[model samples]
Target: MTPTFSQLIRSPVLFLAFGFGSGLAKKAPGTFGTLAAVPLWYGLQFLSPLAYMAVIVITFALGCYLCGAASTKLGVHDHGGIVWDEFVGYWITMFMAPAGWLWALYGFVLFRIFDIAKPQPIGWADRKVHGGLGIMLDDILAGIYAALVLQGTAYLISHF
Candidate 1:
């Protein structure tokens, strides 16, 4: 069942899994959830590249558990409200990106496009994977794709 706001707030895991209530938005929860990640990405900017990677690694592990647990609790697979994947995905998109709001915005747009479009292996993982790992794998792939594009764009702009 889709969790009510009260239920979602009351459960710590659900609260995080739902992207700290941003996923509770009535429409386009993934988009809103991704937006919630923007500020976090800003804070993560202060970290050294190695530390930033560590955070992503840890968060990805936690997301697998959280997303899986929430799915089991709700008896739904890949619930729109379980948007922690989007958070991780956006983080990956911004890795090594040029430091600026415009770059962040570009990463945001790119991540969303890849995530929503689900090209190739992303779509395959979404369809074939199961459990929490399954939930995160697709978004991880999307993030990687977006990151490649974002980094490539940065490189091109710098060179040209």
Candidate 2:
């Protein structure tokens, strides 16, 4: 059965899948969802590389289920309001990013672009995949793309 807005907000899984209510925003919910990930990225910055990776893996796994559950509850596939994928995606984009608000901001911008643009394989995955894995794969790919660009930019800035 499709859940109502009130039910979604009250449910723990849905609340998270919805980006802590950021996804509830009527305007640019995806943007807001990505913005919400910034603080989480900052908090995660202190972890060791291995630990960070582990967390990312776990979050990705959980996001698949959380997002899938929320999607099922809402009776829609990849609903705009289901933004846990955005959260995990942004976190992936910022993984091991340089220490600074500037770097975080850059990661945010790049992630949003790649995610929204859905170029090449990312778009392919979006079209071809379904269910929980489908909901998470495209954004994960977008995060990887953004991460590559962000890392490349950081590399250039540091080396030059």
Candidate 3:
């Protein structure tokens, strides 16, 4: 049986999976969830590259478990309200990005585009995979795509 909203709120895992309640937004829950990640990204920017990578790895592992558990409780797969994937994805996109609000904003826009567009392999994974890994894989791929673009853009700006 699926848990009610009240029950979902009571569980710590569900709450984080829900993006600290940002996923509860009546409209564009995914957008809100991604927005909620901005602050987190800002703080994470303080870490060294190695530490940042470690944190992301940890977060991704936890996201897989938390997302799976939450989906099981809700009796749904890849529910829109579960946005822990978004958090990790955005973090991945912003990794090693230029240090500034502008770069952060760029990463945000790029991540959202790749995530929503689900281009090529991202779309393939979203269609073929299931459960927690499924929920996380597409977003991870999207983040990679966005990171490539962001990094390329940064390189061009520096060289040109």
> What is the Cα-based lDDT of residue 105 in candidate 2?
92
On lDDT, who's better, 1 or 2? Answer: 1
For candidate 2, what's the RMSD? 1.6
Task: Give the least accurate 10-residue stretch of model 1, judged by summed lDDT.
Answer: 1-10
**Candidate 2: tens digits of C-alpha lDDT, residues 1-160:** 4345687678998888988888887888889999998998888999998999998999899999998888888889988888899988999998889999999999999999999999999999999999888999999999999999999999999999
Scored by TM-score, the top model is 1
**Clashing residue pairs, backbone N/CA/C < 3 A, model 1:** none
lDDT of each: 0.95, 0.90, 0.91
Instruction: Indicate which candidate wins on lDDT.
Output: 1
User: Model 1: per-residue lDDT, tens digit, 1-160?
Assistant: 6788899889998999999999988999999999999999999988999999999999999999999999999899999999999999999999888999999999999999999999999999999999999999999999999999999999999999
Q: On residues 60-96, what C-alpha lDDT tens digit does candidate 3 reach at each position?
A: 9999999998898788898888999999999999999
Q: Where is model 3 more than 4 Å wrong at Cα?
A: 1-6
TM-score of 3: 0.95
TM-score of 1: 0.98
